[model samples]
Target: MVTKEVRLQSTVAGLTADGRVHTLSVWFILALRLMMGLAFFQSGLDKVLSGEFGAGGYLTGAVPDSGSPAADLFVAMGNTPWFVDFVNVAVPWGELLIGLGLLFGAFTRLAAFWGAFMMLLFYLGNWDVAHGYINGDFAYMLVFLSVAAFGAGRILGLDTYIEGYEIDGQPLVERYPWTRYILG
Candidate 1:
């Protein structure tokens, strides 16, 4: 029942209204995203280039040689041979994928989730060695987790579009009780 002219006017009004809240500084967002993405991407690339495919083998003898805490665990796990080999193939590639996703802002939220997850595992691994206490491991993990929690991509990545579309068409996911706290 709406006329074309009326629809056009409403569209313009909606865009103007949305523009107010979409005033996130583009340069700042790009810088944050680029820096974070580059850090992840480079790490992933290094893992592959260094032949640390799964990061398992690297964890094993690589640590004990440096007198690391998980020496026993790594040595024991490395003895598995098969498991270490599997990790060598899978983990490094996973890092590469995660890095690429973040660097390109392809799936910012998902990349952040994976990056945070990786940080969690790394932190746990370090904790197992350190036996708990103030350590940089946990702190780094928290930082990545914080990014995921806030949906950092919303600042300048594809997440902005994703959020906008969702905000416009379907508010269901955003309305979830825990989504706000998690996705911020």
Candidate 2:
């Protein structure tokens, strides 16, 4: 057997960083995608089936009580009648769609982007400085980003097929480079 390594490099603020990842780590990447997918799917399914998922109380009461820095924004959103209605529909449906995308590895990057965004919001809303700023929600957000960055969908995922589909005798990614943002 041969060991495989993936070299990664990045530059930010004139600082360069580089690292190598073991190919065997792919399993963990896939695991992260599946775990989040299942968790979000189950949570969304329950919310949809129960038809009792309302963000108003939590956004206004819980967020404010939690002393989150963004409490005012959340309360504002909760107070807006139209926004609340939108949230009533968006939260469950968004979670369901995001979960499905991640589970099947279709539109994986797009799904992960939304998942990260949601996690960021969750982190802010559930803020607790008692144990430092980092929390599960923040960690989950990073995981979603990692999934996107690693293109986890390309491993035994529909995105692989989708990206390879032919268009004008060219691969999808080659034909539509912008799709890279959402695919993979």
Candidate 3:
């Protein structure tokens, strides 16, 4: 009987531990969202402020001996005038928006999805052969996917408020049907 009682006590302890973990996980995502958002925002700002920044140099340098398909895409796009022009503007603006969305916890999943996409490109573009260490992009991709999967914004974001938003005494859905994706 004592052994059965001990087992029951241990089971209760384990259940409580699991509950604590679930409760605390949101805070971790909140931290990730803030830090990642700031990092992306700063990178974009640096590019926007720099007068001589161009994607061509980086893209051209991505030529790889391993014959990565990603390398081929970068090399091909490096020379096109339109691609260069578009990338130069898009990189900064896209980073800024993604950062804002993540920081504010508005459209958290969509922003995280794009962030992961950008990280994938970075992962491919900067694959180092000599260095055995995994690149930062892989970590960033997982972080983004986690954020989206957990809906990190709801914990400490405008998203929670947006869900409760009322416009002119009408429900959020009444005012705009599309906001469900952004708010949720």
Candidate 4:
């Protein structure tokens, strides 16, 4: 087997960093995508099937009790009847759609973006700094971001075909450059 090396470089705040990635890293990236997809899909499916996933109590009670910095905001959202209603529907449906997108590698970046956002909220809402600042939610959020940055969808994913689809003698991505944000 041939070994391929991918060189990565980035500079932030006058600091430079670089690394080399082996081709074998692709499998791990794919695994992260599939793992998140399955976990979110199952969680959403259970919530949908049970028809009893309410965020109000946790937002108002648990968040405050956990001493999260965003407790006030969470409580405010919980107190709002309309917002609670919206959350009820949004949480399950959003997870379902996001999971589907990741699972099929369709609109993967979009899905990962939302997934990361959800994980951020979970990180804040759950608010457990007992051991340290880092937790599963934080780790999951980073994973989602990594998946998007790596364009994991291109690896045996529908995004590859979708991006290459012809449109007016040009590929879809070529026709609409903005698609790069969401397609991969």
For every model shown, the clashing-pair count is: 3, 0, 0, 0
Model 2 whole-model lDDT (C-alpha atoms): 0.93
Question: Any residue pairs clashing in model 4, and if so which?
Answer: none
lDDT, candidate 1, 57-125, per-residue tens: 557646567565556776777778787777676666766776666566556656667777776656545
- Best of the two (1, 3) by TM-score: 3
Which 10 successive residues of model 3 have the least lDDT summed?
1-10
Cα lDDT listed for each candidate: 0.59, 0.93, 0.77, 0.93
- Residue lDDT tens for model 3, 69-127: 68878988887879998888888878888888888998887888889998888877877
Query: Candidate 4's residue-wise lDDT over 60-178, tens digit each?
Result: 99999998999999999999999999999999989988888888888999999999999999999999999999999999999999989999888788999999999989999999999
Better of 2 and 3 by TM-score: 2
> How much does candidate 1 score in TM-score?
0.57
Residue range with the least summed lDDT across 10 consecutive positions in model 1: 2-11
Give per-model TM-scores.
Answer: 0.57, 0.96, 0.76, 0.96
**Residues 60-178, model 2: lDDT tens digits:** 99999999999999999999999999999989988998899999998999999999999999999998889999899999999999999989898778999999999989999999999
- lDDT for 58 (candidate 4): 89
Deviating ranges (above 4 Å) for candidate 4? 1-4
